[model samples]
Each structure stands twice: as C-alpha cells, then as structure tokens.
Target: MELRHIRYFLAVAREGNFTRAAARIGIGQPPLSQQIRDLENEIGTALFHRVPHGAELTEAGMAFLEVVAQFPDLAERAIRAAQRAGRGEVGSIRVGFTASAAFSPSVPRVFRDFRRSYPGVEMTLEEANSAQLVAGLRDERLDAVFLRQDTIAGDGIRLHVISSEPMVLVLPSGHPAAQREKVALSELRDEALILTPRAVGPTHYDKVVTACRDAGFEPQMGQIAPQLGSVINFVAAELGFSLVPKPMTQLQAKGVAYREIEGEVPIAQLSLAYRSNDISIALRNFVSRTLVAHRQPRIDE
Candidate 1:
C-alpha cells in the first residue's frame, strides 16, 4: 500500500524467515510478522506458506515479488533526476533578444558557456525587438532577454548592465563624412536619417530624438525600419545615415562606415533583463559569467 509496505514485503520474501527478515530490516520479529499479516489481509491473499522452521512463497507472492524487484532501480533514477533539476543542471530556458544583440559577442558567448556548464539543460532563443522582449518577460513567455537599457521601463523586471558603448554614426563608405574619424551631430542636421520604428521601443526612439535635438537642430527623419539589421542594411546601400551602437561595427556591412559622435551624451547601455521573480540558478550564472568574460573595455574618445 505504501513504499514501506513494499520494502517490508520484499525483505520478508527474500529472507524466507520472519526472524531473519526482521533482523535484516532492523525491526523486532513479532512486529515484522504482524506487518506481513496485515499486508496479506489488505491484499486479500496469503503471501507465504507457514512452516515449523521457515516460509515458502505463495503463487501470488512470487508474482508480486517480480514486479516489486524493479522498484529500487526506478526510485533511484527518479531521485537522481530530481536532484539534477534542483541544482539547475537539467531544465529548459527560453531567451529573447533584439536583432542587434546577435551581432554582439555577449549573447553568443554567454550561451556557449551555459551549454558547456549545464549540458543537460536545453536553451531556446527567440529574436524580437526590445518592446516585444519586455512584454514576453512580463507574460512569462521568456526567461530572460538582452536589450537596450533605454527601452526598459517597468519596475517588475530586474536588469543587469552587461556593457555600454558609444553611439556611432553609420554612413555609406563613399559618403564625404565616412573619411572622418568622428562626425558632429550638427553635420547630419539636414541629412535624411533612418529611424528605428517607434513600436520597437518608444523610450529608445525618444532618446535618439532628444540626442539630435540637444545637438542644436531636429533631424530630417526618413524611412523607419523594423529592426537593427534592416536599418544597417539600408545604411550600407547609402539609402540614409543612422546612429547605432558602437558594438554594431562587429557586423561587417560592405558599404557602411562608422564614426564616433562628437558630444557628451551618455552612450547606449546594453543589459540583461529578466523578471524579478525568476530564480533560475543557471540563468543567473550564465548572465554574470558571460558579462565578465566578454565585456568591452572602456574606451576614451
């Protein structure tokens, strides 16, 4: 009826003598014998044939013993699995990211470290804009995400800043300003600028606009792109110029050239965002170690 009953029955059946079985199980002979009697009564079948010296199994007893013999192995395996899960070595995690994050080394490096450390855990990656990633975190659809700090607003999430890099002006390689090491924001005042879609993250779009305004003039807004990769592609084709995170230089765009912006505005911050309630040990270690290993060194311009 219970695990103990199964264990007791197996022990008595194996030893074939009530006194010996009780001794092996570290219990008194009378109690062990009474327990066997109770078990038989519950099953409505006699499990042993009484004899003067010892006992022999009934047909039903032999059948039950064969099935119960497999229990020890099954129980051991179940306990091992539970232990691994508790230690965060075996589980599934869903991660979301912006398109630009893929271009950076932080995401890939962290994932590689996580896989090596916890080979039993499975990771799923989803690509979305910062706004969508934030929504996914709130709805419990994503375990964590790498996104721009400006876009994060809600208080229910915790953020760990991984790196910060200055915004670069991306221009066509053949453009006149491309030859320069740095470009002033005022130089692009009259030039058409490709803008990231407002739906991508309102806060991020506003920051860009504010930066341009602080430069003494409003930008000539051109076409809006859905994601960073597309915006970079457009810049490569000389469709328009755009300001992007400096790490984006890692992504080689054939006709695109990047330059540091000449101003005192704060650089973009990249952070790992997750729900405050999430307590995944694997996720915590992955985020922390990856940032430490591949973080960008500070550069003074």
Candidate 2:
C-alpha cells in the first residue's frame, strides 16, 4: 500500500520470522504482524503463511516480492538523481563568449576543468560579441558568458571580472612600427587604425580611443573590421594598425606582428556574465569553478 508496507513485507520475507523481522526493521513484533495483515487486506490477498516457527511466503506474496524488490534500487536511483541535480552536477548550461574571449587561455582552461569535474552536466556553447552575449544572458537564452565587458551591469545581469591584461598593438609585418619591440600609442597618430564597430565591444573600443587620447593623439580611423579576428586579418592586409588584448596575440595570424605599448595603455578585461536571479545549479557550479580557476574575486554583488 505504501513504501513502508513494502519495506516491512521485504523484511518479513527475508527474515522469515515475525519477531526477527520486527527486530530487523526496528518495529515491535505485534506491530509488524498487524502491518503485514493490513498490507494483505489492501491487496485483498494473504501475503504470508503464519507457521509455528516463523512465516513463509504465499504464492501471491512470492509474486509481490518479485515486483517490489526492485523498488529499493529504483528509489535509490531516483534519490541519487535528485541529489546530483541539486548539487548542479547533472543539468544543462548554455554558455556564450566573445570572439576575443575565446582566444584567452583562461576561457578554455575553465571549460576543460568544468567538464572534467562535472561530466554529468551538459554544456552548450555560443560565440558572439559582448553585446549579443549580454543580451542572451538577459533574455535567459544563455546561462553564462565570457565577455570583454567591464561596464555592463544592473538590470538583473551580474559581472565577474576574471582577468585583465594590457592591450597590445597589432601591425602589418612590414609596418614601420613593427620594427620596434614596443610602440607608444602617440606614435600611431598618422596611421589609420582598423577597428571593429563600436557597438561590437564599446568598452574595448572606448578603451583604445581613450588610451590614444590620453597619449596626446586623436587616432586616425581606417577600414572597419566586422569582428576581432577580421581586425587582425585586415592588419595582416596592411589596412591599418589595430590595438587588441595581449592574449589575442596567440591567434598568430600571419603577416601581422604583435607589439606591446610602451607608455600608459588601457587594459582589456574579460568577465563572466550571468543572470543575477538565475538559480540553475549547473550555472552556479560553472560560475564558481570559473572564479576559482581564474583566482578572481567574486564581483557579483
């Protein structure tokens, strides 16, 4: 009739004695006998034969045992599933990233570590610019994102800055500035600077512009690239110089050389963005692992 009834029946069937079954299952002998009688009444069939020494199973009881024996295992499996899900170990998480953030070593490292640790969790990844990723997070289409945005906050979106690295210069291999190991932002005044659209990553775009102005120059604008990678490719084509995060130098795009800025420069930041109200266990686990892996402090407040 109930799980307790099943458990008592199993205990009596296994022990084969009323008193022993009662002791095994932590109930009184009289109470155990009455429980078995009640179970048989519910099923409208006698489940045990009361013998002189103990009790034996009837034909119906044997059949019932065969079916209910599996309940314990099944119940255990169900409990395990619930526990795993509660701990964020066995659900799906949709994650997004910016084009440049993907190039960061920390991004892949965090993903690898999370996958290894929570193999039961399903992960889906998307690549987009910072704005689109933020939109995805806000719209609940994405559980988390790695983006190069430091100013986006509020409106139920939270930001956790993972790492910040100095911005570098990417120049055509044949460009005059490429000859120097490091170039100052002010020196690129006359050279047209290739860039992605300001909307693609306003923080990064503004950082470059502000850094150049701080260096006493209004950077000349050249052909615009649609994305971060295209900005590097255009630099390879000698369209113009591009300023990018130092980590992006790992792209190793041919015909382009990466150089550090000599004087004051803006640092590009990579942040993990998520819905402030998201209660997904998998997403929480992912955010925790990411912050730990990057040794970043929690900035979600």
TM-score of each: 0.84, 0.94
List, residue by residue over 240-268, the lDDT tens digit for candidate 2: 89899988988988899999999787899
Best candidate, TM-score-wise?
Answer: 2
Whole-model Cα lDDT of every candidate shown, in order: 0.80, 0.89
RMSD of each: 4.8, 1.8
**Candidate 1 structure lDDT:** 0.80
Candidate 1 lDDT over 126-169, as tens digits, reads 99999899999999999889888644675888777777777888
Worst 10 residues of 2 by lDDT: 292-301
Residue 130 displacement in candidate 1 (angstroms): 1.5
In model 2, the Cα lDDT at residue 176 comes to 86
Error of 2 at 240 (Å): 0.3
> Measured by TM-score, how close is model 1 to the native structure?
0.84
